[model samples]
Target: MSQKKPSKCKKKQTDEISLSKKRNTRAGNMGIGYETAADFAKRGANVIIACRNKDRAEAACEKIKKETHNQDIHYKLVDLSSFASVRKLAEEINQTEDHLDILVNNAGVYNVGNQLTEDGQQLLIQTNHYSPFLLTNLLLDLMKKSKSRIVNVSSLAGMAAKMDLEKLNKYNNFFTDYALSKLCNIMFTIELASRLKGTSVTTYSVHPGTVKTEIIRDSGLVAIVSRSIIRTLFKNATEGAQTSIYCAVENDLEPFSGEHFEDCHMVERYKSAQDVWIAKSVWAKSENVVQLR
Candidate 1:
């Protein structure tokens, strides 16, 4: 057998091929998250990109407009890590749009070392749970009018969590903190669904799967790991975004509100996530924390 050495052009082409594949597979772009936004915009749905970074959100909106040829995509500034910012974003959305057809709670933070928000709550809990909770509540009326769908970008981590209602502001372990917040997300989704039972609006929680996004880089520890190593462990953002997209546009899912999803399929969540007592307590505490009651 003859031994062959890879050519430089072949290697370059292979790298680009892999890069393109990874980009196409990320959950942020692949699944219903961004792609659905593009589709909705193309179909004349006025889509808004709620994000903390105005520059990035505008760039994304521009790309969507250019690619989808839909100029209606807009951006709203929101910092999910801060309750005040979330409120401002919700107010802006409410003031501008008469009806919001879809609200995708896709913004998230992850795996960072101990950090706190402006309100003094743990950052992950505030960003991944409280902010979204408050925003959804603030915009509930608009959603009701539009018969909107709220898709919460939850995580598999929630299943591994147990909530301690008394200590929402404290977490003995970092990963546990993330997991618990995700659990809170699921509980909130179910409770919101119950509240909207007789209304036109619906809510759902989804696990976007392990995705390779800037979030991992944002984590001080994980950022040290070689890129190649992390790439082997996770799908790109689009693959992680699959469930959100499915829940957003799939007609079959319209009747499946308040459910938990993974990889575009509805699945039962952790039993604790469905406990009415826990849900109520969390809801009360959440409202108090956000001052939304």
Candidate 2:
């Protein structure tokens, strides 16, 4: 279950007055996204939680705000599966926020079936990768207003995946599509960083371990067993959020832009993740599909 609005965080730390400004941020409000927002909120960042469910997102926002004592936390309805919804949220943020300091593409899905979105994109790929792909591009202008950081939440499932648009549609199975989506996130980070170089913006991808979240709650027996195992064998959202928080705020990491991080440190990734050609291809295809300018 998504954490109940946490009790006022007994562990919440305070910052100097100078550090207490309303920083613009937008992230998913589930799993590591919740902890990630709490971390930012504890530090006085203005956080916007985006998700498909407005009521849940709002409840999450309230809980986070109370716990972190950061009333600036709010929720916006966003359906990642729909390009229109993603674009609308991006446009709203860009117009309303003078500067976006942190953008965490941390929301994802893990369903056990194959289906297409109303937009006709594969479900998992659209939700996990393409939605963020399009959302990030639309928000780039506002992010540029600050020395900003964008964190794309990825996973180990992507280890060996490559972007072959011709074969992309053929990957209709559950695990394969999810894996490819994660890989696409990594490549998006790589290519987006290259594109944003010297522009005071940086992007990074994070492999939050098999977190015990509702991500797999609906995928049937395997997911139930996997969730149980994840609870036993892997990190919770708080622990999983660590690396994402590190990448978004660690001052020293400015040097490692575009890198993949795990356990709060940068590490070597699947060599296939370094395929610039694949990254470019993914970027081009994403642009075309999203019809970016």
Candidate 3:
């Protein structure tokens, strides 16, 4: 979540912030996402946080309402591992909500094993890249109704990723798969912004810094040591959430759409992420995977 700063843009009383979450998301609870949602609520924006867990979602909503004094805060159910769940949530939102002003594809997994979701896609890739791609596309129509910003929470790990489209679903190693997923997030933002050109919608990919959160699910001695080191040295949830919140509310960001952001400011895109051809190919592959014909 963001700092409790009021939005610089003109506000409609009905302006809504719709963000995606999941049960195993590292950013859930008092993580970066919760802070991002809380900041928005403090601004009096109608916020809908979609998560897979019912109990946690309700508890989060109630806590945000109490803390921000914004009764407009609500939650919806969604499991990023399943396209059906994503589609269901999207359909519900499109039917019930008038417009979506901001969308943060914030939830992701780290080093989950080489498993596959029910949709038959690789579990890590589906949760980190494919589901969010599908969710963002599904919500584009409603977002188009108003000036909107879509924030894909990418990672610095993306910079190290070497794109291999054929192996996107075939995991090589824990770090490689996670890096590829993050790289896809940036590429998706680029392709999405190109497609949304001339419209009122803009998109950004953000590296929320090395945050200490539950998304780190690696194992073994090295993994444990790395987690401990990360917890000791990296930014906390509040610091990690700043860029996401900035992307959501920054008024002058339209001109920088499709760019990468860090430290709450626009930054250079990774060399691989800037490749238009690869980005387009990733988009095509994602469309086929999500069956968004």
On TM-score, the leading prediction is: 2
* Model 2 lDDT per residue over 1-293, tens place: 23232112111121221332457777767788888888888888888888888778888898997898878898888998899998898888878888988899999887746677888887778888888999999888888887889999999988956666765555567777778889989999999989998897899999977788888877578877897888789888888888787777765466677888887777776676978888999999888878887
Better of 1 and 3 by TM-score: 3
What is the alpha-carbon lDDT for the whole of candidate 3?
0.83
On lDDT, the leading prediction is 3
**lDDT per residue as tens, model 1, 146-228:** 55688888888888888897656886576788888889988898888888988988888988777666665553544667455
> How would you order the candidates by lDDT, starting with the best?
3, 2, 1
- Runs of candidate 1 with Cα error greater than 4 angstroms are 1-36, 218-230
TM-score of each: 0.83, 0.91, 0.89
Per-residue alpha-carbon lDDT of candidate 3 for residues 1-293, written as tens digits (9 for 90 to 100): 23333333222221244333211111344578898887788776788888888899889989989998988888888999999999998999899887888898999888778898899989999999999999999999998988888999999999999999998999788889999999999999999999999999999999989988778755778679878999889988877888888788765678778988888777778987878889999999999999998
- lDDT, candidates in the order shown: 0.70, 0.80, 0.83
Q: How close is candidate 2 to the true structure, as a TM-score?
A: 0.91
Query: Which residue ranges in model 2 land beyond 4 Å of their true spot?
Result: 1-21
